[model samples]
Target: MGKKDKKKEKDVGKEIVKDKKKKSKVVKSEDGIPIITAASAIILIGIAIYGYTVYQDLAQVPEMPELDLNVWWGQNTTEPQDTSIRPYRIVFSDAMESEIRWLFEMYRRPNKKKSFEDTAWNYGVHSEAFAQFFSYWIFKYSFIQRPKFLNKFDHFKTNIQGLDIHYIHVKPNVDANTKVLPLLLLHGWPGSVREFYEAIPLLTTKREGYDFVFEVIVPSLPGFVFSEAPARRGLSPHQMAIIMRNLMHRIGHKQYYVQGGDFGHAVGSNIATIFPNDVLGFHTNLPVNFSKLAYLTWVFGSVWPTFVAGEHVDKLYPFADKVKFLLEEFGYMHLQSTKPDTVGIALQDSPAGLAAYVLDKFMIFTDPANKNDPEGGVQKYFTYDKLLDNIMLHWISGSIATSMRLYKECIADAEVEQVFSQIPTPVPTWGLRFKHELAHSPDFVLKWKYPNLVGTTNVDFGGHFAAFERPEEFSSDVFKAVKAFLSFKK
Candidate 1:
């Protein structure tokens, strides 16, 4: 009786264990749905959050404060708005002159062991060229006479956006009945209003083919020279464009034309984009595209040369080589864009350092190949006096640091990409491509970014400093652009 009872108990236990194992297998196969569903839900939520953040970032446009011009000019409430154009002259103090002279005299030359090739400007500013320029600065160049030469143009300072905006206003001495159009000529880095000195007379004088003459107004970009440095940060090119438009308004120019190269191109683009109604037309020598589409456009354009490069396919092709060149040339940009204060302090302290820093850009931008030359090819395009005069403007103003800060302030702005690519300039646009422009984009590439581009001219002689180097060609191209704009309007 005990044996039968033990066997029955064992069989019942085995049946119970087998049933539990079957249920466990079912759970492993079918019960994992909720876990998988939960994981998928978490992944979906993460993606949604990331996409929203990117959209918000891309959609935001930076807001700029509007400045009251009348209040800023220091006019009392009772006094009538002093819109009167007062003549302004550039006068340097004795202390400033002495300081500059001392700095030049005390310049530290490269070590005796340093060869010209070792100090090639392609790597940075060549020591040899800096020595020659320094010699001219100390012995031959006259800062006093330079201002007198600049004074040949009518210079004026007007308060705009709480900053003293200095500009050269040249009117054609034509009959009162002759149609005169206001032209705002903007300059970029390593250049100043001095670049336009030679082109002013050509622009103001009426050409035979063109009926209209340009009343050229070339302003020192804020913080460049006479124009006051921005009191606060975040004064991007967009803000400068606002100040420029206001200046034009204050001068009774409801509508005007604009042209620029380098930083000026960015500022003019902002003007044309933000104030399309006021900017009748726009032109630039250096046209860049910052859109997302540019990547694809560049890729396809590289293979099919004519699509973007046109006849300049040879120059624009071999895109990798261009990238390599850019990487080499972008050291200053990297430094300035990130830690401008570091280099700024060095440049501000030493005139020779400043000359090397500033002149390096002029040399490379004029022609990157010039770096191989011991003189950086400076003598071919720019005279010692002219180059020194340009440097003097930066030296006298002590604006090297402040001007460099623009790169730091504007580079990280979320709006820069949007403004550059998405925002199109609706006004008639023209492009003048010089042979030695630092970054040469073919006319077709330019047209893609500037949809309303009326025409493009590929000039053989000029470079980035086209106005300063080839004033006659620059003036003629400007005349052609203005004529095109007028014709387009008609």
Candidate 2:
């Protein structure tokens, strides 16, 4: 009876094992390879579609146009080449002076309560400070003397792209045989060729140790001062670079060095990007753009401060504080970028308003601490006469509104990021970081964006207006950069 029961149990187990094997085979045949193949095919198709879409977008972007040197003010002039660099002068008319006086006397000041907090500038120019500046503009400042002061530099104008470009072309007081290097100096917004007044002497003067002397050319950017505004819209920094390059070429400088700050930084960078062959070297007081590698390195640098920041660890790390400061300061940029016409109209009509607007930058950008003072500490660094002269250039020329339009045109352009990203500046570059710069960028970050960055100089003094604040230091740095470039080329 036991033997028969054991035999039956063994046969039942064998039957159960066979049934399990048959079910496993059916499951693999039905779903395994086909399901995997379908998922893999779907992923491949998605990748291919994304790749094609990006390729299409990149293909549609327009390339920058070549500059037309022959088209002078859109008229075919058979005039000789010698007359191209015509002598120019600034003449402040009686009508302009009368209007400026009336506007200053009739200005209606806004009611602003004094704040014990350091955020007074958060509300814009201090009313009392603006009042004082307006008083100097109306009564004390001499408009007649401005032209004489400006004429001290060799002023000239050349028609380029249907607009008259005004620039101060000063050569070193040397013999014809002397090899003087051409250096283009570009000024930023709320500033004119006046900014380089102090730096000009320093650059042109032949110092003992410095091997090269500069033939300084400081141009009032298009839509600033005497330079005519763009007839059409969309004159971005890149377009301005084209005009500037053409101006250099017309001046008989095939290859030249460039130095700039603020908006000038953008223009100079674009010049180096688009026409690297023409730019011998580029230097800037303010350098923009932070690559992905910079961000990652910044994070790691936060942990090991000495590796990336060195002595400037405080300036580079604690990112939250820097971001907070930028949020407070970037309000003007927002207004100018979106609807410049709103404030531009106010600035155009009222001389007092224009003075307040431009002088506010002079006060704060010179040193943020100046915001706390009653007169904005403007007189601490800059003379009232000098500041008023700069304003007169804008007022007499009626270029304030058009000059502000650059922010609108460049920022609103859809291809701004694409154009900036695609262009890599292979030319040698140097950066100067002043203590109170709008944003203090470390050397590591500069190297990330500028592949051929030769050096970076950090100074304790000066802010956004480094060239104006410390001309000696600025000129010395320029000399260093030029020397470095010459060395690198060898």
Candidate 3:
């Protein structure tokens, strides 16, 4: 016989031997003939136990919550007791718009002062107060206002973990699937769930047979915007991970994928690590190296000095670079993380200050070359609607103080720790690198934070807000990573 035939015959012989042994061990009492009844009973019991195990494995998947998408598209006029609106409509009249235009024209006509810091403090104080006040007013108005832009999806209000989370869900028209892969998206500081609004349509669209239909969940970080702010202190990113995992389990998605950028990167990573069995994978724009020894070697070798020296053009970012980035890019972090109560007063009182403080991030976060090009930077990185939308969430929620406090709470215990330590994640990971992204390189990414990075792609287009700025590139790269992760099974 051929090798295949011989192997098949050997497997059959083994099966026969096993069955004969089981039959020979059957307990027969006073019966003259050997009792086959005892052997049959033993076989039945084994079959029943095996069936139950298979049933349990199939039963673990959670169900999707029934949500009404229309409520999100409708007007929201309800005013909560804790919040107040600032009167912006009273201050900047339509006539002021025309006059400011003429005033700027006259001011730029000839030689102007190179810089102005004479009343810097006074100006800053006034700006923050005005921003805080106006943010609330504009936000409330927009909440009830009609949306001019057209999109395929609708928004909804869902209560998760006793807190209200505003989310958006989309389903494709051409090839709708009853069940879809769940994708949870998380945003970082100075940003809200509004960041992914533009990419929702592109994400929900199908891609031939490989269409991994996604039921996307985008929740604002607690206290950041719409989500309820916790009154107690000491809620770290790890705690948030627990809440997210629970939310996933409660929502019937025991297995799901996650994506994050900025502060959300930490939360996403934490979720993957603490709940690896339940998580399918995790993706982040920011990946850091965990090994302190490796970092020190690079620092001593002089290859990782740009980040240390505060230069924006850094090749290998180290812990020192992270510190520098925080010191510079995070003025808000200082105020909110350190003395939340003191700064919250200024942001809550002044609308202009809030606008300047919040808008400043947009100015710095965009490509440096496009700083002066106002039309391009904000629009390119995030849409005009999204920027205004996110800012409005902060304004309307009146949680600026509470949100800033979260930074302080999360970092309180590890104030002086050099490296972040957490559980190892079994989830597959994907990293996207944009050319103009603030501080990211493959070497830096692998060295600083993310250790289990399975795929990293460098894209030619986009900047900080990769998903919003360049949807086509962002979606394609995201889908590619999804394919790679789906194919990898441990």
**Better candidate number, 1 or 3, judged by TM-score:** 1
lDDT string, candidate 3, 1-490, tens digits: 8999999999999999999998786646686545787667889999999988755433232222232221221124364322221111112234533543354354336653332234332222233323334444344434324132422245544444444545555555554543367888888877777677767776667776565756787766777776666545656676666666665665567898898877677778777766678778777766554334444444553565554433324434555765565565667666676898888878765544465577667655645444334232443455445665566567556777777776787668453222233233557888887765665544543523444567887656556766656667777776777778888875
| Backbone clashes in model 1, listed as residue pairs | none
lDDT of 2: 0.79
Over 232-281, each residue of candidate 2 has an lDDT whose tens digit, in order, gives 77777877888899899888999999998988988898888788899999
Question: Candidate 1 residues 17-75, lDDT tens each?
Answer: 99998876555326565555667789999999998886554444334334332334222
* Maximum-lDDT candidate: 2
Query: How large an RMSD does model 3 have?
Result: 21.1
Q: Pick the candidate with the highest TM-score.
A: 1
Residue 294 CA displacement from its true place in model 1, Å: 2.0
Per-candidate TM vs. native?
Answer: 0.82, 0.81, 0.64
Clashes of 3: 25
Q: Report how far residue 156 has shifted in candidate 1, in Å.
A: 1.2
Candidate RMSDs in order: 6.6, 7.0, 21.1
